[model samples]
Target: MNNGYFGFCGTPTRANSQNLAEKLSCLHLDAFARKRAEKFGLDIVTTSWEDNARSKNSCWGPCITDMSLGVKEDKPHPRDFLMSMIRKPNYRDETCDTPIEKFCVTVGNEKKNSSLKRITLKEFLQDIALYTDNNVKPMWRDRDSQIVTSVQA
Candidate 1:
């Protein structure tokens, strides 16, 4: 196809993925996907971990590439987004920020025969969250845990 790069999401969980093991996994897998895509003429874009605060160049590389490759006019460029960021104060999330509205969410799993369900975000949270004194909190969070990365061909 075009002279573009291939991408893979959900690594580091984006480390622009979530941790060290994930970051490395993303980098290596990005390399592998790139190679595979070359054979079929495809370009995939993924957010990867950079040395600077694990961010710095995260979007810069992909943004430039996207613009150069003729992204749709409706999509905002990174530079335009930055300009909007400076003037973005009116938007608000009533569900998460104010709790005034309960947004509907789709919940499901990858298991076969499992049916998806649409429920209020608050209701979904009640299943996985703990409530005390009217305050809602998550059941648990990752805390400096180590993870292993491996690949097989």
Candidate 2:
């Protein structure tokens, strides 16, 4: 399954870019993505990034490695990541956003079974928890708590 990065909606200035990174970091994206995938009954086969060679190189050691799957420190470029997913035949675009809002999209066959609904951050996290309880091993208890706390704050 492919996952899009956050904060890819517009041309960001330097300050805006930093703000985006901070937001992404606070979101704990890797954990959130894993939970979302599980909620949709999808197993993560692998993860990848789409970026120019320079960006890829810079991200390689810390960001794109297998071990970095849920690492909080690995901030990814959302626009590049989302564009990469858009190119894939298996993914379907489910949501759109303007420069001021964040973007959301769906991957895999999940779209075939359900209508595309707007996914809120809270709902996404709840879905993740549901998926963890029903389909997979119970591993996200702490992560869910963290997400809830983060969201509340």
Candidate 3:
């Protein structure tokens, strides 16, 4: 799993570049999948972004280590911290801004799964997202919450 910064889509600024940035910013995950999709010339099926409100140094650090690590000086792996934050979105679900806390991953037997773990705020940031029906893929399956698809016009 990958982690970093995140945000929600606003409105399109330019034609595609600005619009793409807004859509990308709205996702609860980093630009990993988006970047990968662009790299492989694959059609974008999801709108995700990097959660920048969490940490600067590393997402999996000071917070977890602060409690779990015996030594106060030892640093934890940044990836671990990033994973934690990427699991949850930092927003309310009452309005268009629904919180996204799960990530999309390929599981064995051709299954996709999203894992929810505990992460420290000092370790990871969160992505703010706007509500939309543009999502056609399931964020995670065989999990607790039922995944829904929403598209944006």
lDDT of each: 0.34, 0.34, 0.30
Query: Judged by lDDT, which candidate is best?
Result: 2
For 1-153, candidate 1 gives per-residue lDDT tens digits of 223543334323333534333333344345565565446543333321212112332433331211111212233333111100111011110111223124556666534577887775545555554223345665333331222111111
Candidate 1: what lDDT?
Answer: 0.34
Q: Please state the error at residue 79 of candidate 3 in Å.
A: 30
| lDDT, candidate 2, 28-137, per-residue tens | 34565446544654323333332222232254433222211232344453331211111111122122223211323342335447555565343444455442335643
TM-score of each: 0.23, 0.23, 0.13
Residue-wise lDDT of candidate 3 within 1-153, one digit each (tens)? 134323333443455343333344343254564454435443233322233233543444332211111112223322211111122121210112223344242223322364444442212222111112243443333332322322221
Cα lDDT for residue 119, model 3? 40
Q: Provide the lDDT at 30 for model 3.
A: 41
Which candidate model has the greater lDDT, 1 or 2?
Answer: 2
